[model samples]
Structure formats: C-alpha cells, structure tokens
Target chain A: MTHLPYIAAAYALAVLVPAAYGLAAMRRLRLARTRLAALDPRPARRETRRETRR
Target chain B: MTAETSAAPGGFEMAPRAAMFRSVDALSSLATPAPPKAPGRSLHRFANPGRFLRLAGALQPWLTAGGLILTAAGLVWGLVVAPADWQQGDAVRIMYVHVPAAWLASAGYLGLAVCSVLSLVWRHPLADLAAAEIGPVGAAFTGICLATGSLWGKPMWGAWWVWDARLTSVLVLFFLYLGHIALIRAFDDPTRGYRAGAILALVGVVNLPIIKFSVDWWNTLHQPATISLTGAPSMYLGMLWPLALTALGYTLVFAALVTARTRAAVMERRIRALLMAAAAREDGAVQVAA
Candidate 1:
C-alpha cells in the first residue's frame, strides 16, 4: 500500500471514464430509438415484414 | 383538318410525324447500353445498417455484461490476489489499468483506420458511423492511457512527464484522435465531414507503427513492450493472468460502446432523413396551394 493514492487514482479513472461513456452511449441510443419511433414507426414494421419474409 | 391530323409547314402530317419521332426515340434508347453498376455492390450486403443494428442490438448486452464482469474480476484479482512485483512492489498493480488502456489506445486506432478504409474505398454507410463513434471512445481511452502512464511514471521514473519517444508518439495519437473527432463534425454536410475524417484517419495510421516501435527505435525513459504478439510475455504468470483478463475486458467494452454509439448514430441519421422528407412534402404541398 505504499503508492495507495496513485493506485486509487488510476483505477478510479479507468473505471469512471469508460463507465460514464458507456452509460452515455446507452442513453443516446435510447433517445435515438424513441425519436425514431416517434418520427416513423416504419422500422419496427419493416422488421416484422422482414421476419415474415424470412 | 382535324387537329390531330394537321400537316406541318414542312409537308408532314403532325400525327404521323409525332408517332414516327416516338418510335425513333425508342429505338435510340434501345441502342444505348445501360450504365454500369458501381463497384463493391457485394460489400453492401454485409454493410447494411438494418442487419448491423439487429446484430449489434443482440450482441451489445452480452458484451457489456461480460466486459463489466471480467473487468471487475481482473481488477480485484490484480489488486488483492496477485503477488506484487519483486522490484516495483505494490506499485506494479497500476499495470492492470495502465497496460490495458495503452493496448486499447493502439487497438482502437487500428479499428478506426479499418473503418476509414471501409468508408473511403467501399463507401460503406455503416463505416462512417462506426468511425465517428470510434473516434471519441478511442480518444477517451488514449486519455486514460496518458493519465495512468503519468501516474505510473511519477512513481517509477521519478518524474510525472518525460519527452520519451514512446510517450511523445502516444501523445501524437491522442491528438490524432481529437483531430478526427473534430473533423468529422466540422462540416454542415455529414458526408463531407465523414470523408474528411476518414482521410485524416487513414493518414494518421502511419503513427501506429511509430508508436509500436518507438521504444525499440530510440533510447527513452519509457520501458519497452512487456507483451508482444510474436514473443512470450516477460512478466510473471500471476501478474500476466490478471492483465490478460483486463485487456480482454477492455476490448469487449470498447466494442460494446462503439456498437451502441454507432447504432445511435444510424438512428440519428434516419431521423434526419425522415425530417428532411417531411419538410420536402410540406414544401410540395405549399407549392401546390400557391
């Protein structure tokens, strides 16, 4: 535990940066999906049609 | 004379002349060949956004969960269970974070370069989106690498910063990522922005080899690569195991983030196109009213 402070700082950043980024990415995706569905629900309908065609 | 059968001043009947011209035009069109299809049509099959979105949606959850689980496990093992280095003591634990971030910094850029090629050469729609998404994430990881390296350096190298070849090259990479992120968003037209960013990414690729060989090519305060593809690792097995786990975890997390971001970008583009179409329809209606 000699360099405990340095270790903690490094690990905190390694975890926090990616965690924050990942959460933001997921949120953006959710918002995009919601907006897309509102603007045109055709994507969902298209998916259904695709499944049927398959 | 009936309007349909009226003769022109040139002594030809209007109806027959019109019919004759129509037939000649048809024959001329038939004689001309069709335009050639664009190259890389085959790649379009795999580059379909709808297909990619479905695959990414399915894979995102698994990648996120697995990445989080493995990263947590590896960090815990490295921090608590793994033995400390004989020389560096407990300070060596920083490797769990630092090394993985460094690896990701390099690997992520390579991914960006591949996306750039796909965008520039094949004109893959998803590639531009992927590159746009990858730039910010790669920059973040590169930032993490630099920060963690500084932390490790302060303890090991007796200074927080040094102008070593490896260090300076990585710093250049960080700026390259930043440049790409900015260039891709600079234009009002996203297509133009993507093209500019792709060209920059392709050009920046030369820095990769320089970053890789910098430690060997020049004398520096920074240490040479501890793990290499062609050679066995120089670290202890106890330390190596956790490092490996964390490296894999970081990679998975990187992939998940990029996929999710790219999915969002695709949705955003679709929304933009829909809005533009709606606006065009409104304009047409106004024109009709006018």
Candidate 2:
C-alpha cells in the first residue's frame, strides 16, 4: 500500500483541527470582549465589588 | 451565550414591556455607580483580572512567534531531512507529528486533572475556567493522535483501527474530553456546570495512567515507548532529533493555546458576571416602581 495518502490525511487532520479550534477561540473572544465592554465600560468598577466582599 | 443588548439611540432600547414600569428608567442611574478601587497596600497581583489580561496580552505575541517558528523548523526537518526507517520507509515519518500529539493528549488531560483538583479543593477561581477552556484543545490533540495513529497503522498493521489496548484506551480519552465539554455546558448556571465538570474530570483521570501503561500491561499490537528516562533510547539519533524538535514545538504550541484560551475564558466569565449584575439592578428598579 502506498503510504502517501495515509500520511497526507494524518498531517492534514492534525493541522486542520488545531487551526480550526484556534480560529473559533479567537472569534469567541472577540465577541465576548465586545459584549463586556458594552455592558461595563470600566474595568475598575468590578474592583469595587471585590473590595466590599473583602 | 450571546447577550443581546440593543445599541439604540443613547443606549439599549428597553423592551417595550420594560418601559411600562417606571423602574426601567432607573437603569440610567446605574450608569455611573462605580466600584471603589482596592487599597494601594495590597500585594497580591495575579488574582487581578486586569493584571492577568495585561500579562496575557504581552506574552501572546512572543508565544505565537516562538510556537510558529519551532513548529515550522521541526516540520521541515522531519519531512525533508529525517531518514526513513529501514522497515517502514516513509511511513515512519508520521512519528514526528504523531508522537508529539499523543504526548500532548496525555499532558493536556493531566493539566485538566490538576485544574479540576484545584477548583474543587481550593475553589481557585481561575482553576475551573482553565479546566473549562482546556477541554477543546485536549480533544483536538487526542483526535489528531487517533487519526494519525490509524493512518500509520493502516500501512503497517494492514488495518485502519483495532480494539488493541492502547488504541482503545486513547479512544476512551477522546470520549472523556467530549464528556467534559458537554458536562461543563450542560447546566443553566455556569457555576453548577463547572462543579459538575470538575467532578467528572477527577473521575476520568483513572484513564490517564491506563493509557500510559496499556502497552506494558497488556499484550498489544502497539509498540512500547521509544523514549524512556531509565535507559538509552532505541531510536537512531537521525530520527531522534526531529522527534525532539517537534516535541518542543508542540509543547510551546500547547502552552500558547492554553494561555490564549484561558484569557478568553476569563473574559467570558466577566461578561457573565456583568450581565448578572445588570439584571439584578433592573430587578431592584422594578421593585421600586411596583
């Protein structure tokens, strides 16, 4: 059996899986940050709750 | 989950029904209710989200560059420079990618297990988030290992897959990753989901040692470990160098991934918290209007 196809399939899947995952993560992160900024513009405000809890 | 808030006029367009309650107007009062900053004397740094975000932002570029360069260099050396095995010919070249991915599948789970323990025992805020983010990456690497192993196997063993101990255990590892992902997102409350997922992760860890020892413990078609700390490696140096390079490259890639994903997870949690606070404020306004 020619090992060429097997080798190609293996490498291709390996690269594709990680690349796909990384891209999806980046997309999700971008959307999340946008929503967060809209909801609470000031990161400092969150620190207030921590202070009261302490 | 997407938090749908309208960007109408000056701010969100309150739902039509929300306008019926005069309390809805109170949302405007919340606009400037700032939280007091922590005192200057505090020494703890990393627990701060702002600090962690800044650190992640700074490190990401360097991590990306290093991971890409190492992976590229290793792939080139493995594909173009490494000699083929006498018995397997070019098929053995798959080892460079295959071995590193397999190692990562195991390593990533171990990391997940550690995060699970930390989350459960110490209630480390970052631990559950890290554990949650790691599931996908671990699953991906596990998938790669299985696919590559199958590919290599077809040529060598004359079959695409078998119920051999190593292969079967790794399959179980893949399912465990899937289970973690599904369980973590299964609940309406994220905290509950995290707790459930952490318990599942702890239980699933028994599979790790089994996956590692499968070849030694059982008579299997899978070969024994090529590299061992106890004695000299059986592989030739020509083959060893590429494997080493790819292993380092893959590890850096995994590190970069974990860092990036963890940062994203933190942001997601922040969004959830902020949304909940906003809802609570709205509820208080409604009560006053009533």
Best by DockQ: 1
Off by over 4 Å in 1: A45-54, B1-40
Q: Clash pairs of candidate 2?
A: none
Interface DockQ per candidate: 0.65, 0.39
Candidate 2 local Cα displacement, residue B44, angstroms: 8.2
Docking class of 1: medium
**Which CAPRI category fits model 2?**
acceptable
Please report, as a residue range, the 10-residue window in candidate 2 chain B with the lowest summed lDDT.
Answer: B20-29
The residue-level lDDT of candidate 1 at B245 comes to 71
lDDT by residue (B1-290, candidate 1, tens digit) is 22311222122212222322222121112113323452344556545566656666666677788789889988999999999889888889999999888878887887788778878987887788888988999999999999999998998889999999999999999999999999999999999999999999999999999988999999988889776545556777788777767876787788778878887988898899899999999999999999
Off by over 4 Å in 2: A44-54, B1-45
lDDT of candidate 2 over B112-210, digit per residue (tens): 887787678766666677788788888988999999998999999999899999999999999999999999999998789989999998999899889
What DockQ would candidate 1 receive versus the native complex? 0.65
Q: Alpha carbon lDDT of residue B211, candidate 1? A: 88
Worst 10 residues of 1 chain B by lDDT: B22-31
